[model samples]
Target: MSSSTVSRNSLEADQQWLLRSSSPENDLDRDERPSKPRRHIVAVLCLVLMFTVAGYVTSSVLLNNRLEHPFRIPKLPHEEPCDFAPSRPSWNSMPRHRRHAFISAVQRLASKPSRLGLSNTSMYDDFVYVHTKVVWQVHHHAISLPFHRYFVHIFEQALQNDGGYDGLMPYWDWTQDSSDPLASIVWDPWAGFGSAGNGCISDGVFARVGKFANYTENGYEPHCVTRNCLAHADAVDESDGVMHSKHWTPAIVKAIIDDSTTYRDFRQRLEEGPHKHLHAYGIGGDMASASSPNGQFIPQPKHTLSRIP
Candidate 1:
């Protein structure tokens, strides 16, 4: 073979070898470039997933804490009742300003919308609704007195917390002025619970304030608090030979207190006696219905912190 031809063939063979090596290098570069991007994408996805899990865990923990320890207002030192002082007093014995303050608080609560829902017009309506709903379960049962006592407590709390009342709730001691209940001091037109009118109350602090929003007879209507005084005559013993008008007198209350030995006995006598009579005479309209307006006037047991115990 000629030397030039041999050299040319050798050069061509070298070129082919170089081309093959270059092709492999290009393929490796392309494959490696795509693999780097894939690795980067996987790392980013892992980071995003990790953050999502961390956030979920944090929120769950916070929610559980919130549920476990619900928010509440701490009681102040002054809220505790003094040992020597009376916690509740008769309505007639309450200070004039305190009575007015309570009345004003009730009016304020009556004006505010119910927290239960918008369907209920006012806070007073919510109370009436609750009474109506639970009337069957609470009345004429062992739980009656306890239920009513708790209910009154809740009402007093609302008066303080929501209505901004400062005085403790006062109860009407019907026996104190039972001789002439209609002319009782608590029925004064200027400063008391107001006197009975035709169908609705027309005098005193609660007069034509028109705030009660619900009633069994009339639902979701604006109306004033109502009262009606009914008088009854009781026949005397044959030896006495004279009949006289009767009222829920202190003597009856004394008898009940003296006669009652057990809680059930006390409840039965009180319920069947002065309690029933007061409801029959004191309230009219829906207040006199089977579902009583004043939760059947469950009397607090003598000398106790709570009406139930």
Candidate 2:
């Protein structure tokens, strides 16, 4: 054969051999292979969705049981016996030393290392994390009151155990100050949750004191815990120190309680009505946000207010 014809034939043979020897992946392209990342993302998404659904179902069942039997917590034999005798007094009724100690405990807890998650955070910040995280799930539902009650109890235990507080779980009885919420002893600069703020508080125990959680895109960032005691939506109450106290008069709260014909109704009304106003109008800042509990720098007032009964 001629040299030109022979070279063309050899090139064709080499091309065929190369194609035959290559694997299917090499024939197509390595980049065209199925994406492991996409599969992993799908698996992770499925797991997240499964856990979320399970959590919701479990929460619903537990909340329903809580509704049916509000005080049916299972206790160990060695656990402290239930005592109904110790009266849960209002914040106003607590003595100076008790209030001071409780405040100290709260501060100590806030200052301590995180017990819930992330060693970088404080134990109190853990409360803020869960409170902010589950606000949507627990609030505006049957679990609202019960969940908060349990949360407060756990917080109180933490205070006693970690903070060395040996006093009753304090709470703010808003009814006393509902007519003039600002003047309520809970805001006492010397002994209470410190003074109010237009933006961030500038005076009192928590003055310029930063918190580990502040409702940011990044879950935990140390910032000043806010208490906007002057913020109000009502044009009339906009500048009033009492804020929207008119809507929360003792009679108004009584009516809210009395008018609620069903448990759900009562819960819904209380959650959406005075409970909301007290946080939004009565005290603004973080309380107005999804994480209402983090609004106060001084949790003693928040704790005191949380103990409804």
Candidate 3:
């Protein structure tokens, strides 16, 4: 109750004091824990974050150079008065009967341009006349190819004589690329503006004369050429106006089929009649220059010859 009791009581008091000081009860205990950032450091971090965001936004803006749209180039126009040296024997140089026959034949073509052949069909009559005229003029040495202007005039006349044209004549729309410079002829039905050929290169009849016999204008043209003239179509099918030599009229073929004897005799007479004249009067090259292993006759020659300025 004296010395021992007093010593025990002092030890208990010292233990309690040590526990309270070490158990987060003193300021020194708080100092031992991690401290929060200073306001200045927080402000500096916020400023750096803001600057980084602003820089990203600025970089994004710079990367996208504002342009409304893309750029494009244009094409050039075509040259006129198509380049072709006129051959001998002016279209008018022929006798009146001969000229009338040729003219009549061409005029007739406009009315029945499409013809029955064994495997294909030709263009409609008016188009046929114009196209054939061009081909013949180019290939036939005794004929001169017409300029584009006179060709147009003859075309107009042909149409008028056939009871006036309601629409424009179909033209070879050579705007697109040509597969062969020497043997290619392109035509678009909707190539002209307004009335029939409006916005299209077709006028209900157009034939793609090449390795592929396609009718882009009307699916009927190729049929006519193929069905009636199988032999002629096959031999000179690939050739343009300058290559085809043999031309068979529907009447002739029909007559031949009807009566072989009469047909043969008539064909023989027809051949012999014009054989010498054509052979002797060509531009020094005979029909050979106009010949193609696989070709059609050159068209529009008389049109060229009619209006030589």
Maximum-TM-score candidate: 2
Q: How far is candidate 2 from the true structure (C-alpha RMSD, Å)?
A: 22.2
By lDDT, the better pick of 1 and 3 is 1
Candidate 3, residue 159: CA error in Å? 1.6
| Tens-place lDDT digits, model 1, residues 214-242 | 55533555555544442111212333111
lDDT of each: 0.49, 0.56, 0.27
Model 2: how far is 111 from its true place, Å?
Answer: 2.1
- RMSD per candidate (Å) reads 35.8, 22.2, 44.4
Residue 45 in candidate 2, Cα distance off native in Å:
19
lDDT of 3 by residue, 182-253 (tens): 222211122211111111112213223222122322222322121111121222343321112222223433
TM-score of 2: 0.68
Task: Kindly report which residue pairs in candidate 1 clash with one another.
Answer: none
Q: Highest lDDT: which candidate?
A: 2
Worst 10 residues of 1 by lDDT: 68-77
Alpha carbon deviation, residue 171, candidate 1 (Å): 0.8
lDDT of 2: 0.56
